[model samples]
Target chain A: MRRALTLVVSGMVAALLGILALGGLSAAATATDKEAANEAKSVSEAAKRAGKKDPYAPVVYGDR
Target chain B: MVEQTTGVGAPPVRRVRDALPLYAVAAAVTVLVLAPLAAPGYALLYDMVFVPRQPLSWDLVAPAQTLPRAVPMDALMSLVTQLVPGWAVQRVALGGAVLLAAVGAGRLVPTERLAVRLLAAVAYAWTPYLAERLLIGQWGLLLAYAALPWLVRAALDLRAGRDGALARVVLAAAPAAITPTGGLIALGTVVLLVWDRTRLRRSALVVGGVALLNAPWVTAALVTGAGGSSDPAGVAAFAARSENWAGPLVALAGTGGVWSAQATPSSRAAPLVPLATLLLLILAGVGAGLLRRRLPPGTAVRLAVLAGIACLLAALGVLPGGAAALRWAVVHLPGAGLLRDGQKFLAPYALLLVVCAALGAERLVARIDREVAGVVLVGLLLLPVAVMPDLAFGGAGRLRPVSYPADWQVVAERVAGEPGEILALPLSAYQAYPWNPGRVVLDPLPRYLPGTVLTDDTLRVGDVAVAGENPRLREVRRVLAEGLPVSATGVRWVVVQHQLPSEVDPATLRDLEAVHEGPFLTLYRNPAVPPESNPPGLGAWAVVMALGAALLVVMAAAISALHRRPTAW
Candidate 1:
């Protein structure tokens, strides 16, 4: 029983952490997050105006 | 073959309970002794280095799918700071480290006498190496240091074929999730566990338990290509050098000698103070030798040999052959980069020295009355504190924390409504904020701003030779040096300091509009950009691995419980 319980508890904690990460559950970014996001968006928009493609898309590094 | 005489004969849980009062006193004294770290609203030296801007969420965990350093320790610290103020969290965390060290020392030392155990606990908690590390602001490494004694105790229990050894080892191995040093110590404990061939199966279970506890960080490092460094210059700079053999020796006696920031050179007495301090420790060590007969012969010899070997390895850089050997291994082997800070090896040596010193002092005062013996024991306990007054109430030579500038808060509010990543110029990680004169601190920008803003000012890894590899980091640097690039790097806002770089042409920024202008900061926004929608490709893989890791931990825990012995000895 003790061994079984230990397994259950460990499994639950690990699964919970995994779920948290996998769910992409944004626990609501503060005012600061909104500002930082907006700022980056603004820069991407400027890039678009300068004829850049998909300026608002995620910046993927090819080397990574 | 041998009857247990280390007082570890009793079940560990019972032994720990019996010593609860002593542990409490040790913890209380630790907090009192290091009161300066917990001063109201004043942050410790490196609190800002680890403080994340936003609270710890699922996003902090690294696994190639998330940001780097998804280690539990970082996440734990970030989570705590979100609820508690940063300065208070730093103080409590530091205080908790000393308390943990005290408890581990109390539990590990085999002495039966309460006074002797308590004295050893104090010695282990208040050593020169502890002070030097604290002053150097390596709290993550210090967490591992605090956990070393618990590892030793758990290892010994496993060797004795005691019940619940696997459980204890798992509990003690918690530090590994935060710092690799803890993982290294956990490895040593595994070697000790497996040393008893008859108990090989049980020991393997303990190893599995440790691996499970460390899965989050270990998995992250393996998956993310995060660990390893081959920088020769960093190796030279951080490696334990034998150039001054006496430096580490004196440090073991509670005098400072690692980095310039941690080094303490007395002016009035000059060399005499350090020499005298060394002599005093040597005298205590000699006393310990006289009482060596009291220790179980096997345990005493093993600890002594271990201490000697650690001391040798810590000072290996003194010789040309040793230096070459370390350099070779660092370049050829993976994970050997951690040995660059070779002084960390002294953690175990210091533990052994304090235990032995306590035993020696116990014998020396054996004949005295209880009151006088108590006084002598307390004096012995305070010896390290007396030798290093700077780490005591003096706040470790740091002053009170200064509040952030009002302009920063105002700018943060103005930028909150914007979306996408933001960049701050001039991009630097560690800065000497004019508001807090005379102290260097991690840049407060990340803490004040929200969401994934990018800055390369802080070295992600400490003093490692790996050059900055991220093209994004390079593009950001270029954008800072030259004006905003012809192509966008997905940065929506550019926050330029009051004094812009000479090469940066404001006119070159297309569709740029000034949102907020201040004496200290100017915020520019590109109105043409929209909010980011696409997620990274690895996000799904990360979630899957995370769930797999959870299952692995469950299996390991079950194995540990299967090996558990009945409570009755």
Candidate 2:
């Protein structure tokens, strides 16, 4: 009975951690994706504003 | 009282065998949190700026006009980057902060259980306080966060009259003393923990020594032309912010209420985060009793008082009537502006919380069956990481390093060829470069260039603009607002950065001659102004003397610590 109770509690804790980890990682990835999309959208908008004058290509500082 | 057997006289192999797991766990935590820093370039986030080789200019060592925010930190960075490249220095600093913080917390916990120690290590190192500070690029504060546990341990040892403990206290506080806020925190910790009427002389000596370490910034503040008062608007702008529906006070309770929304981890906004915080609080309460029983006589009460004061300070800006009081104090009281962003003061509370929670876990496991104890311990160990997993891989790649444009080096070379005061145009304090997408960084020109570079000091938080204290910059702004030409400002050179939303009026460049025009930065020379070298004055020398004295204390402490037999630290 004691061994069975231990296994049950351990399983519950493992499941909780797994759910929290998955949720956190998914949210983080979504935030990163959203940031990249916004960057691309801004670049496009800036190019449109510039028309044919230099195309307004900003220098790349670093990459992930 | 809690078996102070920190492997002092244990056999060498046995000590290493016992210590191996703690070190391994710390190493794992460091690697997990700072994985993105393995990349080559510098991570230029908000206030975190790194150049190839920072020049040891007088302005960096002792600010003549502005407040000494960076103070001795910039001076030390300039000195070190002269020998080691800035990239390596950045990596070592960030990595060492994470590793040392974990090890320090793990060692400081008054427990013999390796699992409990490991729990404290993971919890303390992976805290939201460290995460938010690291994300905001306040590496100096993170150094203090890392040094805190060691400082607390040494202070405790000093209270107990342990040999070599005073030296340990000095050595532990040296890294923390690099910045004004960190130095003040270290000083407060020593005074609170080491003060005893019976050992009044020793306590005074230790407190005075830490105060001397803080002297460099204090001396600089006195000599600066910019008066001590700060803008009252900053009190509202830098107040602890609410992360989610839990509000700001609860956020502070969890050690996560940094001012900037951009610096907070996304997982903190989860609805269930407050539940985790509540659980941790309950555990800490349960373990508080254990801590009181285990620590020597009055040590636990002193620690509790210290933690309470830290929490109160962190919540001060958001408390009832707190904002009004802080606003008045910042305007009327000197150096009270430091209390505006009170969330930074939460380091001691976070440390105490983690230690208590770890002890609480130990107490729970003590009553449970062995198998169930293992399961509970594992769960608690994973709790912090599970709740805030976004802190991994450099805050989910927010800390990715980027290389500066060749234009920076080109501009630096020209400025070095002919030393002169240069003005960074477009008049914005923070820049959101297309190159560093989705990140706002302070202008790197001040640190990257050789001579004094004038950048805007006004800080804009969302819609609120807090005024700066630089009289020269204020005058420059006034001239520009009046639509004057760059030549009329009397700055030797003007560098206009392109590709930002802020537009530079073509009329401002009327009387100036364009020097080197890069794709990113355009350098123009003002023929009306001539290059002049200003030698360091007496005020600068006073700051230098203070820095020298602080360095000597640390050196003396190091020699003493190394020579002592059976070191308590």
Give candidate 1's chain B TM-score.
Answer: 0.78
Identify the runs in model 2 with alpha carbons over 4 angstroms from their true place: A22-64, B1-5, B565-569
Best by TM-score: 2
Chain A TM value for model 1: 0.38
Candidate 1, position B463, lDDT: 23
DockQ each candidate and list the results: 0.01, 0.18
lDDT of 1: 0.55
Candidate 2, lDDT over the whole model: 0.86
Poorest lDDT segment (10 consecutive residues) of candidate 1 chain B: B260-269
| Residues B1-569 of candidate 1: C-alpha lDDT, one tens digit per residue | 12122354688787667778767867765764455454445442433354424443333545332223336655566667777776666666677778888877766655667777787777777676776566545676677778778777766766766676656666666664366566656666455433555766776676766666566655555555333434444445554422133454455344234432212212212344465356446745765674466544466666666666667656655445767777877677765656655676677677777776767777767866555566566666655544444444423334244555567666777667655566665554444444444344455565556545555532322222233323466666675467655226557776765432122455655566778787667777756666553353464356446535644664564566566645424
Model 1 TM-score (2 dp) = 0.71
